[model samples]
Target: MIKTKTLFTKLFLSYSMIIFLSFTLFGLVFIYIFHLNLYDDYEELYDFHYERLQEQIAQSAEEGWSDEETADLIQPSLHHRNYNIFIYDNTGELFIQPEGDAEYEPDQEIILTASDEFVSEGATMNGNLSYIIADSFSVPGNEETYVAVMVFHDLNHQYQQMALMVLIPFIITIAFSGGIIYFISQKITAPLRHMNEAALQLATGDFSRRVTVSSRDEIGQLGDTFNYMAEELNSLEKMRKEFIANVSHDLRSPLTSMKGFIVALLDGTIPENKRDHYYLLMKEETERVIQLVNDTLDMSRLEAGQIEIAPAPYNLTRQLQRIAVLLEPQLERKGVGIQLEPEDTDLFVVADKDRIEQALVNLLHNALQFSLNGETIRIQLETTGDMLAVHVQDEGKGIPEAQLKHIWERFYKGEKSRTGKGGTGIGLSIVKSIMELHKTEITVKSKLGQGTVFTFQLPLKK
Candidate 1:
């Protein structure tokens, strides 16, 4: 992958090149178009006078004027018009080169007609490119008289100066626009650089790192999303660390107790009269360890999508009653009562029987765990439209509003300390996964002082 600094450089240089190219192309096209549109007027004016001069020479010959008189008639006008006039006689000899030292020549010569115009490209005395426009007309005695005009490229030279005049602004505009593009590129790459830094921190297990976001554009939204992801990862990391500590305590305490009990039994420190009680205590500790491992494995499997649910019709109300019976011992120990609301009715629902059973066991266990003595946990059933809804509501110490949302996350027991209780922490997550596999959702409604009602619905069998 390319470094962010290199990426910024690429963006800056690419934008600068585009702006530079655009200005260069625009300047060139503007000058070329202006040159073509304004080019021909000077040449046309010179050709007009050459033809008129031909007519004047013809009239002078008819009236029998002398060469000196003819020269006196048109000499000043010819110099003012910047023309080098020529006259060719019948034999095609060098007839008259007026303005005697005019070092100019037309590359070709031709006879004249009413609409005849001849233009030849030639060079001036200083070797600069020039144009010669020539015309000939008939005079007295069947003489062939031609007039040639030489005009240097001073117009094109003026166009060159004009191009230079426009070029200064173009260079200045390109430089200014390049600066603006660099600023915009900085704005674009700054957020990405921050995100890259945060990502590196994240890779190093620093989930607390976050990017600053301010704009409302797509980049801003990306920054916002990155920060949100970091928050969630921080939360999950916290949960993971807590879970590890809890699991460690849970395993170590049980194993330590079991080991102590075994050592006592092996050494006969536990009297024969109390050996049975010690054995039972050890067995209970072993069961706790087994339960913790099983719950952890179940959560992993569910999250990995390794557990597939098979939906079939089952009596949901009867299942709830069975769960109540199975948890009767815990209820009795807590002096709690399990009551089923409208228990006489049968509700058939489409769900995986084993998965639903697993889910009900967890919910009832949780409800009983938080419950106080003489508190009744109500298992309510009803047909809501096309589905049968089962609500396991508990009269225990209700969960706080803040922790209610995270109840279904793995190892997220809001109160954290579950001393003297049997909870593997991922029970609610397993239940939620089971419900989701049945194409349904488990929802909770609770207040801090009031109670919590866990509700889940399954499709009713028709």
Candidate 2:
């Protein structure tokens, strides 16, 4: 469909054709008027010459001149004009032809004749090479006689001059008009050409490609809009990839754990009395699935801007103490010591207490999972400037460099860090999302063989 006539081509053809036809019509009208005016001027000049010859004929006749004498009078006048003049009697008989006006020599009997009704006005003859203007009057000396006065003006030279004047300008006008059309067409089509190329790139899945727009015109605005659409599609594609990876990992871990325990029981690896232990393991896998579903629901709510945060002044120290006490049983079972260090005063921040407590629990749980037995997990609360920060430091085999950045991503657990019964892997992602909704930030600092520290900061109350 795009291969058919496009907008630019249609507009170009429409405008160019309009210009061409308009200039052509103007040129033709101008030349036609010029030719008509020149012909009218030539007629006026011929009338003047005819009137002068009539006066000369009347004067010679009043002088009682003979035919030869009248011929002498007319010859000089006709010579000055380079015109052919003649006179005819009333009868259709031979009359006098002016000297040098006949085909024969001057001494020859040049018998010029005319009909009784004399010809007048101008007439073109001899293929329009000559124009004859004739006027007739009664001779004053002989009342019974009428004579014809005629002038023949050669028009070949005038015709050639007019043709050149009209033809040369027309040729020049056409050449100039064609050059203007070509230059303007190129200027208009250049930007459209670039837009065409950008569209092709988009079709081929190059969402990163964008058209460069330099003006605020319609075409430029179109380029900007296209670029914006490309950027949006690129962002959506990245989100799709992240979601797929997270979902795949989330589903695989629990299935693997459930399968292993079920197979052990079926193969009688455990005695009948110990079969209850396998059931507990299967129950744990079911709980991981439940936790994963709940975390996904919370994430959806946060992203859709539907989760309302209930903010109030909360004792930051009390929440920290509560988390340490709740996780003490698990910490002691792993032989990991829990320590809570407080500031000079009870640090307070404006936040939802329940949500903050949940986030702290997730952090402490993550720390305890990686810590070895006999290692210490330190929990600290401090105020710096206008913010209260909580730090959970675990002296365990710390997160490796490759896995540090991905800890907060959903269902992301390094191969070596995956314990058979540890977590749903969405705990840290939920914590990160909750902190973001509260306008707080969380960060991690860790090194291989050292310990890992996860810290979160919130706005301190006045």
Candidate 3:
């Protein structure tokens, strides 16, 4: 597998490269434009000087002045400026050459090619690189013409300054852009970094760690989700510990009872005539242990999606009546009566009949555990729209409002004091899992000191 760069490095490099390329292209274009403008100004300045000299020569030619007098009129200005001025007659012969150690020879072909417009060409003058601008002009009131050629040495200095003007600001802007991009990238990734750390802590079983939500953007929403997940994991961890402790206690209590009874019988502590009574008690304890193990296994299979439900059309009323009959022994033992209220017509529901019956048994068992003697537990079935609603309501001391939401959780017993209520504490969880598998929901409405109702809806057979 190939290693990749960190998010911070990637973000910084990506943003920085974008800014750098943009500024660099802008700088190249800016320098090109600036250089063109400078070149235009230099051309205009040289053109003005060339025109002045042409006007002087024309005026002098109209007056019929000698070449020496014309040089005297133009030489002073030529010396003041940084150019080597050369003048030629119409025949392409050298007319005037500026006083310098530089040697020159004027070419007739070059002079004839020159026009009123300035033409620039490279040349070597006095052993240095030089640029020459040449043009031709006609004398006023005279048919004679002359060509003017001006040579400038080292003209690149102005272009160098123009490049510097473009480059300096570009460098400064790029540096400033780099700083801003780094800050922005950090601001964007800071929340993610915190979430990464929180994730690591969570992986290490630190469910209590939560991320800080600093903004109301997507990252902030992610942080909120992460915190919510951590809270759920923390709750689940607590419930897992409680489940293990409960299971151990439930297993050990029955084994300890069975052990004591067996030992008493084996050592003849109880008389042979009374052995039958102790044998029954030991059998009940063994059954209790078996019941706990079966409930635990069933819950695990249900949660692991291992239980395959066979859905078929079944009479809802008959299923409820059968469950009530099955639990009648315990109900009668507690002096509790079950009231069945089915709809007038036979209510057929499409569901896994066995699983639905199991769910009803769990719900009724829970109600029985909380109900008082002679209190009637109502099993009501009603039709709402196209769905059938089954409610198992108990007239027991109702569950507290705070604990109502947690009752469906595995191993969540509402009353810790009633720990020996003949349950594995996972009955309601199994009920909830069954209902969910049927693509429905179960709801409970309870008021403290009032009655509690556990209602679930199932689809009618199509």
Best by lDDT: 3
Which ten residues in a row are the worst by lDDT in model 2? 104-113
Q: Which of 2 and 3 is ahead in lDDT? A: 3
**All candidates' lDDT scores?**
0.76, 0.69, 0.81
- Which ranges of candidate 1 are over 4 A from the true structure? 1-5, 47-55, 58-104, 109-150, 273-276, 417-424
What's the lDDT for residue 74 in model 2? Answer: 69
Clashes of 1: 0
Write the number of the candidate with greater lDDT, choosing between 1 and 3: 3
Off by over 4 Å in 3: 1-4, 77-85, 88-93, 101-133, 140-146, 150-152, 170-194, 211-221, 259-310, 343-345, 417-425
TM-score of each: 0.83, 0.49, 0.82
lDDT per residue for candidate 1 within 292-390, as digits (tens), equals: 898899889999999998888988888878888877766887899988988899888888999899888888888877878888889888888997788
Error of 3 at 60 (Å): 2.3
Which candidate achieves the best TM-score against the true structure?
Answer: 1
Worst 10 residues of 3 by lDDT: 415-424
**Positional deviation of residue 266's Cα in model 3 after best superposition, in angstroms:** 5.4
Off by over 4 Å in 2: 1-284, 343-345, 396-426
lDDT of 3 at 202: 94
The TM-score of predicted model 3 comes to 0.82
The lDDT ranking, best first, is 3, 1, 2
